[model samples]
Target: MFKYAWICKNPDLKGMARRAILQAMDTKPYSTWLEIDLGAIKNNIKQLKAMTGTRLMAVIKANAYGHGVLTVAKAAEQAGASWLGVARMEEALNLRAAGIKSEVMVLGYTSPVM
Candidate 1:
């Protein structure tokens, strides 16, 4: 299981650390980092688009299969994905909270109340 030492609720603070000893200008500054090749994603999308006339829907579930949800979703958008798909409301919420304007649909069962 994964555990985090801190979490911030204030959206105004981009890089705020809720309980870290030092504050930074980027959120998750001290968190584990991964490199996602958005260009590669864009290229893949272009290839897929070439083969299919059907509208493209980017499944961004499970953090884009560990490719990072926000980054992949943004790249997919730039690559002409017609819609973004998430497996849960939290995933959709995260995308929206990050300012993603793509059409998003939750693919999994969800509770009615927030």
Candidate 2:
């Protein structure tokens, strides 16, 4: 079983929480972190769902393409996504580790022998 090592941080204080830590500006020190706007994502998903009138599958991988996976998955789940797609077993396991109960598929494939 793979373990989830990523930590979700409050971006406001730390600045955009990314792979590399960004120092807060000294001149105009404020919340430099880019906060995840989950509500907006949810709204967008809702709009898409209404527009398409079909099921929506959220493809989240590569740590949500550097957008943070766990938080994005949680937001996608809340946004009425019926399915979630990842890139590898570890990524799928990470979503499960994060308490996401939605359907998740790993699109990344490896060699049979690996």
Largest TM-score belongs to which candidate? 2
The global C-alpha lDDT for each of the candidates, from Candidate 1 onward, is: 0.83, 0.80
Can you write out model 2's per-residue Cα lDDT over 3-109, one digit (the tens) per residue? 22445577663444433332332246566677678888899989999999998998888988878888889899998999999988888887888799999988889
Clash counts per candidate, in order, are 2, 2
User: Model 2 segments beyond 4 Å from truth?
Assistant: 1-33, 110-114
In angstroms, give how far residue 102 of model 2 lies from its true place: 0.6
Q: State the lDDT of candidate 1 residue by residue for 1-114, as single tens digits.
A: 234454556654624443333533235645677787789889988889889877788998999998878889989999999889999999999999999988999999999895
Candidate 2 residue 5 C-alpha distance from true site, Å: 28
Ten-residue segment with the worst summed lDDT in candidate 2?
Answer: 17-26
Residue 4 displacement in candidate 1 (angstroms): 17
Structure candidate 1, residue pairs in collision: 15-26, 15-27
Error of 1 at 68 (Å): 1.3
